[model samples]
Target chain A: MTAGIGAAIVILALPAATAALLSVLPSYRLSAAINVASAFVTLLAAVSLLAAAPQPNAYILVDDLNVVFIVLNTFVGFTASVFSATYIAHEIESGRLTPTHLRFYHAMYQFLLLSMNLALIANNIGLMWVAIELATLTTVLMVGLYRTQEAIEAAWKYFILGSVGIALALFGTILVYMAARPVVGEGVQGMLWTSLIAHVPAFDPALLNLAFVFLLLGYGTKVGLAPLHAWLPDAHAEGPTPISAVLSGLLLNVALYAVLRFKLLLDANAFALAPGPLMATLGLISVVFAAFMLYRRRDVKRMFAYSSIEHMGVIVFAFGIGGPLANFAALLHMAMHSLTKSAIFYTVGQVAQVKGTQQIADIRGLTVTHPLLGWSLVFGVFAIVGLPPMGVFMSEFLIVSSTYERAPWLALLLGFGLLVALGALVLRLQGMAFGAPIGSRAPAKASALPIVAHFALVLIAGVYLPPPIVTWFQHVAQLLR
Target chain B: MKGLDFDVAHLLAGGLVLISFMLLYQNRLYALLNVFALQAVVLSLSVAWQAYVQDANHLYVTAAIAFAFKAVIIPLALHRIIAELGIQRDVENVVGVGPTMLAGLALVALSEVVMLRIASEADVLAQEDLAFALSVVLLGMLMMVVRRNAVSMVVGFMSLENGLILAAAGAKGMPLVVEISVAFSVLVALVVIGVFLFRISERFETVDAHALDRFRGDQR
Candidate 1:
């Protein structure tokens, strides 16, 4: 199983690496087919990866820590590819994306899958940084594909800030190496997570302490933490919906994965302050900041971009208040969020296509317009806003409960932030999906399969988390602490 | 030879911080790109220095990549972009150079204090690298904040990346895994910038960003 999963990652990624040639050879349609097929295969591969070895290991073994995330990433990537299959067709029809650029786009899309997968499977800190940068760069191109003025500015902003984040992360990776070099010696082995972590105690406490700060700021920015989240909404609102969904649901988790891995290193040192308070503080700030901004979103994509920030804040905060219960909750939130948010984007993209606008005021009363898309949007919002029986509610409850245990005062702030966010999301959604039909109500013909697939996952997760999944998360939560 | 090694690292790292200041001082788009280019050159030197210090030859590739892609290619590309877009005229400064430098100085001091406090028990090299890194990061942010021109703002961001590379290379034998990734990221960045230049030209007639204020959430 482990071997199959490993091979699957290669299979999903190999086509992208080869598509550079195919793109140049003028076989655009074939390139797109290969790209989408491989992304789907990659999703299956990730599932198999989880099935094969759901235990942490010295190099590239799936565990509860990453099983949910890996699966979510591959699934989102697969669905986005499907959406892109249709979305790109429209772009081509409109002459927005030249077939030339479309070829490049598919190649980059596969490369992105490769990068995210590499990051998730990596057992070395440096490899993880490299993987993440690859993913960031791929999205930068895909986002700018429209080459419109706003698209250009958005893509440029994303590249600049994304580079800065990558730089910080690289430095943080180096610092982790510095912290480990003395104890582990100077070689490839020194950079491996299993090796560095095993010898973390003898490493310099001072280096570990400082390194953690850089790591948090660097990776946190990618995760869209406040004060550093300026690049996020712009990137999301401007990029193709597939890119937006992948960025929020998949790439963010990959960045957080880097932080958590380093957190494990710091935990091993026994000198780094629990790192909980700092994470909690940042998480709280992001939650509050994003919540307030959600009310101000004029663009549909931007509103959900802020939502990504808010949910990420909650997840990071849960980890900050780390315990088995909270950690487990954080992991669960991570999974549900990817499913629900991507499902939301699928609906948003389809709506925008049908209406010829993304302006919230223009897109009124989705239910009145198209029941299938409208109802999906409604259910997605309900799931996202933490309505009862949704998995988000379950995870958030645990986060608040854990916060209550640590600093009841912080819990009040967290609760306040969640409520504000809840109000904002539901309020806008109320108008956009349910009010009197506004503007155009014509529905675009597109595949409904991926949207349905994601919603089903969210529903199943909400209703019944498999016993094995629960057991996996519980053990992994303990391991994280 | 070893005697010159760490000193060279220190010099290259210090050069990065100095170039960061130069970034703050620039009021013209051409100057910003040139300074950014210089900064990238220094960054590669620092990376090469680490390769020497740690006997990690893989870092040599990182150094070469930084030199070729960041210092040479990106600067040339941005210069062409600005000139072609008719934005080669002096950039309109929202913040004067004097106060910006002062703010940069304050950021540098804050970084030194923080790095010193946190890494008191760390190796002297790391202590120095962390302080230098924070300053570069802050200056990059300052560039993003103070500059209204899209191109220079990107230059600031690249300078920030240079600082990170310097800091990363200074760590000595960190790993080769991210080395290739960093190269690929630079390539991706260039592609995006290329896409943006052509697209923005078509819409705004010029690439100045102040015009973008019109698109804010609350229309005036």
Candidate 2:
């Protein structure tokens, strides 16, 4: 228990310390290195936490559920930092970003990591809301880092939508506290997750139902579910590519984590409305909507942003199904999507730099011009689209097959969405990976280490059944009930 | 739970909802800002009254934040921004005043129905407060949708936040940690929106959201 607390403290403290240090450090290279180093140390702490016993308190909780998230969050945080180090250097060379912008960028990156870690670890629902709000604010600032007409516009749109969503979330949280007040008796005890979960069955069902609606719509906006995802593509396309990667990879998952926590709260109440159907319906809408939308994205980043919505849709649907196999599959799919999607963004970042345009019409024939980057992208696209022998395929297969056993009709609807999305991804992949080399053939200077490392891990996960990891996910799946 | 305490809280919260309707009815940015500031002031009073009734001293800090930042500082800064930018013109409306007011009235009814039905077991004070807070929040959203001006949208967002703070303060024995964080988030949100308004005006020469649509990446 003591070790777990120590590791958790280090996980949070490293980022806080680095954010302060990077703000004043004028040297771009040094700040970037420190950013990467801090993330690496945080990841190490998160890994050590996996072995610790569950610790629950008023403010912090370290358990199987959040341990999984913290590990993934920090792993992606570390790799994204490495990718950003090289990616930002190119932006500086091309004069798109100034040194001062890079300084702010590095500091905000650490702050984003800090806030997300805090959000995941917070046992108090109110503290979680505040941390999530801080994460949103930092990302809003970073999204506008370029300060282009579009960047500013995207940031503004994201800020308004994200803030309103968060406000509603806070209202829901307050409602939750109100629901608990009578049962738990008021004070800080009513706001603690450990206390609430233990007492939820005795709370008012109507209040729990109402709170779920608000929490779903509120955090669903951040999850980029359909109807609330307006700011997502714009934010992704206009921001720096590294920020795009983290936004897609980590932030979306963190928001989904928040939603799942509340879903658990609702599930614990015997008379409360089942949260599954609502989540399933929304997840299905996001999947089908994003699938069709993906076909028309003229920009590469925006297309992948749509892809993220689709994957999140699938994961949410799996969780909505809410059985052991489905929960495990959801967990597996989330991890795979984080690795594969960020790898795609990492490749896309370099590809955009080399071609000098994000417009699909301008860049073509990646295989002919840049084979190393091109092939890595091909692998990433295939992985993301859920081709066989990749981890995503394994998880998607489990989700579909399990859904088929439970509700074949819903499975069919899900299958159709997945197929539509698959078609769109394959079509885009064909255009970019083959055919006449269309744009400028500048030499790519970005490192391939992050992409290679992610793909290797994903490939191993797909083909092998690492017993300990399987046990870990199964334990988490059992707890989800 | 006493008569006087509940009545005061109800009156202030209902006044907030009324000002939210006024916010939606405005066809000019200055009028809208003034109405929003009015809502913020009413919100602070509502929060302060809740503090006194609940005997929770921490809520006074939340009330002070709303009064100082939302009511006074933000509106004055926005007023100066408008003067400097020379954009003190009539705000563009997506829907006419009659229709907007009608929609706002409908939203209030909907919120009251929802909150009152669901929270039947809770105390009368909290039940009425939740209903009024939801109305204010929904009306603030309506205001955001009804106006196309960037500055008005910011005002709409902050007013929506005022509704949230009211809800937080109304919940008895809620800790100070959440209240302070709520206040902090509001400040950060205003600063971010303030920065963006300047950047938007500088780049496009207008604060109209329509100016941004031309740059959408997905549009062909």
Candidate 3:
């Protein structure tokens, strides 16, 4: 167990450390190759974590919850690095990015991934908050990397909103400490999740209730839940597409993971208020709001960006329902959403580069232009829109059924929003992939391997459940309840 | 909980909330900067008070940061940015001064009632600190919403963060990392704004946010 954790740290640190070394290595290609190598090594470590049984009381353990998340985060992160290696090469060729900025980007990418892994693996709430903020700061800096007017503006907006959200979260953390102080006594012991959970009911109810509110709002913003989600679309639309993939697929899930940890705390406290309804309300609002907003998007990346918000909303809402049926769906949906959204961004990155614009109207008939990328986009959009035989569809169906059994009206709204979003998505997909090919044929030498690999996973997930994954999610869901 | 004694931290935190109201009162851009600087100094003092009261050395680091970064660097940077941007003539407001003050008063009252109700059973100090923190936060947000000038909005945000620093100190023995990050964030933000403001001035004669909209329109 100790060996596994040591390996995890090495996996995370190696890339960042290597990038630091790579920065001074005269050739940019060599540095990019090293970055990709480090990402693969991290992915290897995360995969190996699944085989290593966790030891109790360990600071970092590959448990049921984080095992899936870490693997998913690293896997997507690897693909992103691969794509970025090539993408940055092009930017350097075009004189858009200097070698110095490439070094910064590569280093920050690893740092961001490390922080994400730390957040997902953390055993303590305080540690989790710090890790997530580290992740946020790294991403904020990266988002502003272009140094253009819009890029800076987007980064500034993200920074301000991210800071405010984090401040609210710290207040919630303080409140949690206050609540636990009497029950667990003040000091390091009170901050640990396992310790807090065991003694939760003994903690003050009012403090727990209030703390949960702050926790929900704070982390909910990171999850890109509506009303508090202003910074998200801009961040996604403006940043490099690989970073967009990480932000949408991994970072949002990590934030929700933190919120789930606190929800478990609140759930353990018998007298404390239920977190279910508040989460449900916010989740539904985010879904409906994003769904309607999706139709009017003139910018392609921004359109999918809103779609990320909508899909995350669906996953959180499913979890908020908090039953075996819905929780199971939520977990599966999270996995599929990460894979598909990252894949979509990968495809989008290729398209945007080929056409040199984020404007949807500028790029036309992807299927004729680049069949590999076009089909990937089609499959990605289909998967994201919750079509049949994709794992997302399975999860969304299960969530609807669960809602139907409990609150029929909410199910209707969920269905309504999903359908509206689906309609807009299909419309745009056809517009981009089925129409006449008007753009230049400058073919991309992009790797189709990642897109194919993700589709295969989503495909397998829809048809069958690997027993270990299903069992793991069920256990975590029961813990949530 | 009932037996716990709190004297100076309590008074200082309350004083910080009272000064937050000055945000609504100050109309001139330079005066608003002065008020913000004062608020940061007060925030630093409160953190220092907590360090003495709670016997934690880490919070003293928070105090030094609050004083050094917020009180000095941010205001000085903002002062220069405003001067360079040529928007230092007077502050503009989307809403009138009177209604904004009235809204600010109502916000304070709402904070008191809400905080008192939520924290009714907690120790008196926490209840008071939470109430004051909420007021400062809400007032900061309120200032941002009401003011049209970008500089004032920045002032309002700095004031809000000053409140956050106070709340962190009040929590007592909370990690030094978050406090340090908060201070570092203020510094990072100052650099970004400094750059953005200079660019704004170079692009357009005025730093009025409305001018930014017009700049966009012209580009489009």
Candidate with top lDDT is 2
Tens digits of lDDT, candidate 1, A1-481: 5575565446445645655655575666676667677777777767777657534444464556666677778778888888778777776766667888887787778778788877887777777777788788888888877877678767767776777787777777777787777777776777787787779888878778778888898888898888889888878888888888888888889998888888888878777667888888898899999999998888888899999999999999888888888899999999889988988888888888788788888888888879899899989988998887888888888888887988899999999999999999899888888878977766576677888888888888888999998998888899998
lDDT (0-100) at residue A223 of candidate 3? 93
Estimated TM-score per prediction? Answer: 0.90, 0.97, 0.93
Off by over 4 Å in 2: B177-214
Measured on C-alpha atoms, candidate 2 has an lDDT of 0.87
TM-scores of chain B alone in all candidate structures, in the order given? 0.85, 0.87, 0.83
Candidate 1: what is its chain A TM-score? 0.95
Task: Write model 1 residue lDDT over B1-220, tens digit each, in one string.
Answer: 3567657777878889998998888877787788888888888888877877777888888888888888888888777776676764576556999999999999999989977787665567767886897789788888877876667666766776666666666655555734553665465467536645453432132454556543433232
The true-versus-predicted C-alpha distance at residue A304 of model 1, in Å, is 1.5
**How do these models rank on lDDT, best leading?**
2, 3, 1
DockQ of each model against the real complex? 0.47, 0.61, 0.32
User: Given the true complex, what DockQ would model 3 score?
Assistant: 0.32
Better of 2 and 3 by TM-score: 2
Clashes in model 3: which pairs? Answer: none
Candidate 1 lDDT (Cα, whole model)?
0.78
RMSD of each: 3.4, 2.1, 3.1
Between which residue pairs do clashes occur in model 1? none
